[model samples]
Target: MTPSTEMFDPATATIAIVTFNRSNLLSRLLESIERMDPKPGHIVVVDNASVDDTTEVVESFRERLAPSQLVYRRLETNTGGSGGFSEGMRVAYELGSTWIWLMDDDVEVIPDGLAKMGRWAPRFKSIQGRRYDYDGSEFYWQYRIAERMGIPIPFAPAGFDESGYKPMNSGCFEGMFIHRDVVREIGLPDPRFFIYWDDQLYGWLASRKTQSVIVDEFVLRRTREIKQWDMGIRHLNASSNAYRYYIMRNRAIIKRYYRALGVYNPVLFGLGTFMTFCKELIRLIFVERTIRGTSNLLRGIRDGRKIANDRSWQPMPPLATTSGSAPR
Candidate 1:
């Protein structure tokens, strides 16, 4: 069947998908995008050094998508989701998209998801307060304040409390729209974060520039094979090292950046980093049984201490690259 072009909007928006070897899931996600209410002006997919026939699969769907609605780029090396999305966002920005929609290959956008998200774009843009109040108790406190202040708290599209905004904390990359201006200001995801924490970092950094509101609408369904590593505890363990390194290093960097602005609070930053290190170290020993995990934990703690003490910001090298095919 020839795809309907009636609902497609060619004016101001584009959709970008970042994929790494998930051909079957990507096919489904593309089909779903084809059925959205206000069809995307452009659809660009980045194949992140997939060894599989993912490139061929996307090509096969070209005929099924509207002309100019589909474009695909292949990467020579696996650049992780952060790099892939960074490159994709850059391409979308250059394509004259006023707003770029970002998603993962495993997420299927609902029929009206894009339209719904577009409706809330103004709310996101008009946001007037801190993306997160660094001194506001805990993260939840900020959510509470946002709600009380008449700001829409972030929430999962469904199956989560609606009274508070919780940042997308998992691999749920669908339903996020990035304004061209925000991209212009914040640049792209930090390439140093080769894997885990990139999404959170994006939201955290972007929140500084644009208002990111979690709308109370289900926009996408993430579909992929369930792996043992995906279970709550195991998933945490799998990312423990990257988490330790980035959390320690980046927190210090952020704290130092604020300090230069006279918002300095070395005591708080140091205390927080130390507490986080101790907590993660305990988790490593009790939950994750690897000596490497323990060793990394200590290394992260030592590095965090140095950052906290010196109050100097230095970017670390990207985490060692791994073949995406490794078992999750």
Candidate 2:
């Protein structure tokens, strides 16, 4: 489908950045935002109980941006990235932003990125831009849900056609540009996820209402490597056990979400879960070489299965507020 060539006003867009500690990285990202040709109308920073000088960093930028444009919400507790984004999106929606651009503090938005999104955002419900590593290598992030298999498949991007946008089923908060209406429709991201798969599930829900796409335009450069594979596809970046827990546990939640939408295949989902467990087990044993981590992954899978069955698992509170910088 052809996107409208009409230009959209950048002022209608707001940027929502979720940060935890890493004051230096947050400052760098804020500085980059300041340089955008057409800066976002408002920038909401959700501080997830950072022990560092993150609040001080936010205060430093207050002098340059309007009071409303620079908002700082310090959570009383560390709500993880999922909760942080949920609150940030709610605030952005309440502020009457037409669109919300979400990202973490670990990346810097390219100067021309927001401008490009504004130009093309009018044609799609959700837009995701490309990302590169700190060393300037293109990060392979293209992924879609194989509906038949009920699992995500990472595919490499081909040359861009004049079509301008390619449909996508999964999304990441990094450089995610979504219309406010999608937020209203799908509701804010489920904070229960607390870290992983939340954005992907939300993106899938958004795709149900309208089109979502990934544009070839470069929008962000990843400053940190959370996960990476070595030669021969060996796991090189061994993430923390906590991360491993969430990565495995969240699969059940994702499956539940798909089931609610009446789009899930039980047999396929089971196969995918078994394959994931096996793959993680091998990576943990041979690549990471951590038996404890493997056990943690197994525990996560077990608990997640229970979580998926619990009918009383309600969503977390919508908003959490605190005064001053996060506790030390």
Candidate 3:
């Protein structure tokens, strides 16, 4: 079924936020949402397993807001970004919402964001048959190829405009709107992603199913700075190790699956994969320079290559929900 084409109603859209352990940021985001011109029908917050006092903070707001104004769920373990958003989307769907607005806790949606979405809804939906529907299928194939080759697909642009507002390559979860029908067709975020790159995967899937856009009218305020890891002992550390494991492992799986379908372009794919690995190696040797840097980088590269070459690798563990902690 397609999303309803009826008049836009704030009561039919549910705004969902996925948060980790950032209580301070979550509070700010909630405050911003509270100030929207047309208030959301419902605000659903899914807390990944957090050790912090996120539950207490959310409870404070629950006490103040009317029952219909807000809803919160705290998972038992950390489900990373994918799991949190998956659960949040499920909640939104169950609420009978026509649209779902997904955002990270660290992002503060502009006051008119929701209204702006309503304004552009018709324009987007109108293009469904002519542009959105046809292009979506083609875009998915292109995206799969790009991902396999390690090419960073620009998210915001979605190939719509040269305007610098490209939808992020994979992390649109920070601030994205989902039409109900899109979710019905595609289902939830792939839980295997756990954390990194989950947003890109979802955006790629949604881009095909409906008219998704990175609206110029609404901008989410990002509160944190992302630090790039250098090549060194730090790169070989636990956090870095886990990050490498997922990125390499997932990409390999994506590559092998496409190859089996005879859609793989080996030359481009190999070049892309080689370049990516080399870049990582350089980053370790020069940028990070930790004591175990080279060794860790090699290990990650080896594992990634094995997965890509053999086309057989064990899947990562299923994500678990963490206590409600604020995102950082």
How far out, in Å, is residue 15 in model 3?
Answer: 1.8
Per-residue lDDT tens digits for candidate 2, residues 1-328, read 3333445777777899999989989998988887777787789999999999999899999877653378889999999999999888888887877788999999998888888887677688688988888779776674577764545674445457988668888778987898766666677888888897788877777777778888878889888756555654222455678878887898888777776667778888888887767767766766677666877788888889898899876533323333112211
TM-score of each: 0.66, 0.88, 0.71
Model 1 scores a C-alpha lDDT of: 0.57
Per-model CA lDDT versus the true structure = 0.57, 0.78, 0.60
lDDT of 1 by residue, 192-254 (tens): 555544555455445655455554555666565322222332233334566666655555444
Compute the lDDT for candidate 3. Answer: 0.60
lDDT of 2 at 31: 84
Where is model 2 poorest over a 10-residue stretch in terms of lDDT? 319-328
Best by lDDT: 2
TM-score of 3: 0.71
Cα RMSD for predicted model 2 = 5.4
lDDT of 2: 0.78
Candidate number that wins on lDDT, 2 or 3: 2
**TM-score winner:** 2
